[model samples]
Target: MMHPSESCNHRKSLFNTMNRFIGAVNNMDQTVMVPSLLRDVPLDDVGDVKTVTDDTASNGSACFQQDADMYSSYVLLKSIRSVMEWGVLQGDGRGKERVGESEDDDLEKQFHFHLNGLHAVLSKLTRKANTLTNRYKEEIGCGNL
Candidate 1:
């Protein structure tokens, strides 16, 4: 039988965070019908991938200039979801890199730090996806999201 601790660990794994991100992206894809409206619409932090990904109410409207657009964000979201499923180095790099015992402490600290960042990014992406869907609905004159 699987240990309870192991089960709990699995829930907190990066895979879990990735799964949630995928779901949000999938929903965004389905909700967006006229994607042309999303084109050239500024968005993100990275040049081609820049925009706001906050989980709270965003100031992202079609009014101001930004980095990426909703369309690009949508595409990026889907691409990331694909990568999580297919994984990095899908064909190779399956072997593990063992860390020295002396580095274990640093590794643990780094892992937690990166994990927290991952959680924050995922939350932002999920919120962005939902926001895009809601915006599209509003454009189409749909009921309250």
Candidate 2:
């Protein structure tokens, strides 16, 4: 029942939002450095508690956390993309007719294809996160004793 222009505008807004989300994620990716918790520790410490001098362990933990955040963002974007695709598919027939059946079908196919690609990327990211976590565990375990 929605007007064609309104539907178009809605889709455009969704696309804009998606772009913004991706941009934010990319920006975060570029600056994904883990801060050292030991930096705040005072040098005047009294007892036998040693300072964490190993930067690798802190950096590894930070990288794992960043990967986890990226994975979460990707999952959210995938859900949003799915909803947008559904909206496009369920739009009034008038818009579909105006856009031409073949064109609409092609657009849908492309959207699905891109979505599948996103899924694959997410899968790879998940595997990388798992590897990072395992590495972190090993490092921590070794460093503790």
> Between which residue pairs do clashes occur in model 2?
none
Tens digit of per-residue lDDT, candidate 2, span 64-112: 2222333333333344334444553433232434444466557988887
Top candidate when judged by lDDT against the true structure = 1
Query: In candidate 1, what residue range of length 10 has the lowest lDDT sum?
Result: 55-64
Error of 1 at 98 (Å): 14
lDDT to native, each model? 0.67, 0.41
TM-scores of the models, in the order given: 0.61, 0.30
lDDT of candidate 1 vs native? 0.67
**What lDDT score goes with residue 62 in model 1?**
28
Q: Write the per-residue lDDT of candidate 1 for residues 20-94, one digit (tens) a residue.
A: 788888888888878888887545344423434542115322211255566766766676667677765533334
